[model samples]
Target chain A: MSYPRLLRRTLLYIGATAFALWVLIPIFLIAISSFTPPNEIYAWPKPIIPSRFSLDTMRFFLNSYGVLNSLRNSILVALLTLAFTLAVGAPAGYAVARFSFRGREAFRLGILITRMFPTALLAVPLAVTFIKWGLYDTLIGVALIHTAMALPFAVIITTGIFMGVPKDLEEAAMTLGCSRFGAFVRVALPLALPGLAAAAMFTFVISWNEVFAATILTVNNRTLPAHILTTIQASPLYFRFAGGFFMTIPALFFMFFIRRYLFHMWGGATAER
Target chain B: MAAEIRLEKVRKTFGKVVAVKDMDLLVEPGEFLVLLGPSGCGKTTTLRCIAGLERVDHGRVYIGGRDVTELPPSKRGIAMVFQSYAVFPHMTVAQNIGFGLRMRRAPKNEIKKAVQEVARLLQIDELLDRYPSQLSGGQRQRVAVARALVMRPEVLLMDEPLSNLDALLRLQMRAELKKLHREVGTTTVYVTHDQIEALSLGDRIAVMREGEIMQLDAPNEVYDMPANVFVGGFIGTPPMNFLRAEVRKEDGGVYLAVGDFSVEVHKEWQEKLEGMVGKKVVLGIRAENIEVRPTPEGGALPARVVVSEPLGAQQLLTVQVGKDVLKVATSTELSATPGQTIGLVLTKAKIRLFDEESGEALKFD
Candidate 1:
């Protein structure tokens, strides 16, 4: 085509490539640090090339302060958040997509409004409630708070997903032999499954990385991120690096696992307006 | 093998906007019934109401003579193929076809046999394991049909199913679909805005307008005798022309006078125009019925050829008669140029008279 048009395309491609590298460098650095010698973690130029590596730092972080249990706690909370989000949020999402009620618009606005509040504001009050309810230091209690935190977003995202599944397809299912609920479960649900998986991934990451509520609500049930925050204060510098490495590795891997979905959700955001 | 479907006095509305109003129709068993209309003419809404996709505000819906107005769609044993094809993107052709059976918790072997049977019937066995995204548009349409057929639904409702296909594919699918219906003998309600498709495919065509059916009749009869000006004008491509005219008595013969030109009313329509010989009326003549002449005769009118559109095998010519433009389809491939002057005669046999005030076609009785 025209020279200016070709030049613009090249520049856009290069700019996107540069942005991806810029975002990944920090993550890459933390991962490499896990292999650096403990003493050289203190050295200048920051051990870009480690002469020797050891599993010592990683092993140490894993065994140090119930870090394993913290990881276990993190998985449990993420899964529980997923379960609660899907169970409660799916029906609510279906309702918003299929029916009109008196306060439907207001309810949608209210869901969005919940996302605007800072999660930190709930820490103290939630802590008091959890202690009073005898759930102060349990993984179950921790998961409940995280679920509450992720619930609104789950509802909003799944609602959009269900809306994308053609309303006619569900009705078609009904005439072929599905009850109203059965059609949702049979036709609509399967069609929206990919979107639901993305919603679950989002809620999982939110629960996994949540530190404020996890820190306020528990001592014994400290999640992975909360445990990392505590470990960084007193641990050796390399141990801190190792802990950060473990957390980012899964986060990076999981993000990559659902990169296609993330692109769609992100693209969907930009495309709508 | 197909179910009879009937909608008696069915009405549906969303707030103040009525989507369907007092719709009453019958689709005979094993018959292909086409709902023909423009977008938002309540054809799709009527299909959804029959499918229970939309609840009726008033009246009843029946399938195979059973009241299913309030029954959930699934229990009514009707299958619908959507305008978009609606093949499950994540599932393979086999899985998509197997879905309804799977929902019923049919035994594994039975589901397999049903899927295979439908796959063969639709000639999509080669695509059984391929996902919808992998299939071409025509193949996906076939898979959707296979999916609905696998359910063995008593009635098949297709909502503009072929509207998304390419022109050639649409024609191909139309033929194959007709053949499949012949073999399967399923009563089908097919909706389309393309009157060509409706006329060609529907055993009986229902021409609808503004949430109400203007006429429901056999394709040939409807085309030959439209109930009103809207049906007369909307049913044909290149449409029928309306010449503003007045009924006048001259030499004891009734005739319509349009501007400086007049066409003698045939003896057959003389009595039809008896009321107020000076009253206004509209004369509707289909394009193909406008005969071109080399020289102006007593009944011939002068016209200027303005535009010529070459439709394969025939050329569509637009002629301006006085202030009115009329389309004429001619099989003679003689290249005609715009700005050419010619004389055209409106054949007496093809003239349809309508009351200009009410738009209703006039009958002698």
Candidate 2:
């Protein structure tokens, strides 16, 4: 390689590494703080590397009032929200992708319009409706709202995935002795599996980290994010740090679970024969 | 099991577009019937209608002796090979070929045996464990054919299966497909836009235009005696040439008159075309049928050569006769040049006359 080209390539690597560190450093500091002793975390001009590691701060956060129950509530709500979003959104996505019916554009526009409204805008009316339906302070009510919030994105993502799969595969399957539904199950569903997994992971993350609707819809069944927000000001910095770190653990696990599909979904690598 | 297929008064429309209009067709048991036409001529639509991928608006479909118009594809007992070769990308070759048997809930051992048998028959047994992504285009197409054939359907439909390959591979697959069809004999209905493919593979060709069949006959009959002007113009390399003329009665016999030149009608056609006297008709003749001579002969039209293209075994001579330019295939050894005068005679070959306005053959069959 020529001198200038080699120098330019080396410079590019340095820039990329610096940018990666810039984004990762804050998350690393929070993670370390979650395991530091309370006194160590409070030291003036705190050491860059922790003097020692301790799980006492994490235990304190877990034992706090309603924290463990809220942790259970968060997990349950995220799973339920993921289920609801897929059940309602996947069929809608398929319909939009495969058909050219009247009002299709209008229906897509309607879904887009729902996303334009901030969650706070619907909180008051939804709260009243939940109380009237006797669903107040329940995990199901919050899950319903979270599902509504995540559904638009899920529908759009799944629509793109289903469109990428060729319709010829389904028609071939049907002609090879499969019914229309059977063709979908045997061909289309398997081809779109990676995209569906990515959509489900995204929904789980949205519901897991959501605070506004969860706080408004329930009191005793507050999700972890809502619980952390409610107790942040009253608690010490170490408790706040541990609570935030605990809230992030599920998102990390969800990413790890769907890592195989993540590159394909985001990079648009068709990998078709 | 081979079975005759029938479509009666099949009409299909998409919104306001009439794709197949009032069509009726029949395929004799184990006969290879090809639907040939240009794109958007409803040939593929007709094949899909037979496959039950598209429901007819007002027609009944029959396979064997059973009316399968309302039956779903699964119960209708037919298999199809798609033009795109839609093999399941996630499955291995063995699994793809065995999918139909698995769907029917056959015993696991039976499915495996059937898959192995089909792979060996297609000479793809060594590739059974490989996914579709690992195969070449021709290999993928073979896998698709194996998948369709393993079902042992009563009928098999192919929609331009060889149109996707390169020219060399297409020729190879075309011969293999013909051999397979002869051995299996499953009453095939193939569709293609290439006339060569239709002529080489079809026992009978159905040429379609504007949602209707223009001619349904054997390959040579359609080539030599096209039913109408469209079929004449649509088939053959460099297509058949056409000239505007009128039938005239000069002394008791009939002759076709064109600008200052005429050819007496043959005795066999004189009676059939007697009613066409004084009527404007379009005469159709193939390029190879016209004979070019160096000197004027009896009843030969004099013309100027516009271009001479030598193509090894024969030469294509474009000659201008009066106001029309006609392509004549002649011997490559016959020396000719642009602006040179030549004598063109078409009396010895078959002639087709069509009603110029309606574009239909003039004589009743």
TM-score of chain A of each: 0.87, 0.86
TM-score of chain B of each: 0.95, 0.96
Clashing pairs in 2: none
- Listed per model in order, the count of residue pairs whose N, CA or C atoms clash below 3 Å is 5, 0
- Candidate 1, superposed: residue stretches over 4 Å from native: A1-29, A40-46, A94-109, A267-273, B101-118, B150-152, B310-312, B331-337
Query: What value does the lDDT take at residue A42 in candidate 2?
Result: 88
The candidate maximizing DockQ is: 2
DockQ, per model, reads 0.58, 0.74
Which one is best on TM-score? 2
Interface RMSD of each: 1.9, 0.9
Candidate 2 chain B, run of 10 with poorest lDDT:
B345-354
**Tens digits of lDDT, candidate 2, B209-282:** 98999999999998988888899889998788888889888888888987788876678788777887789988
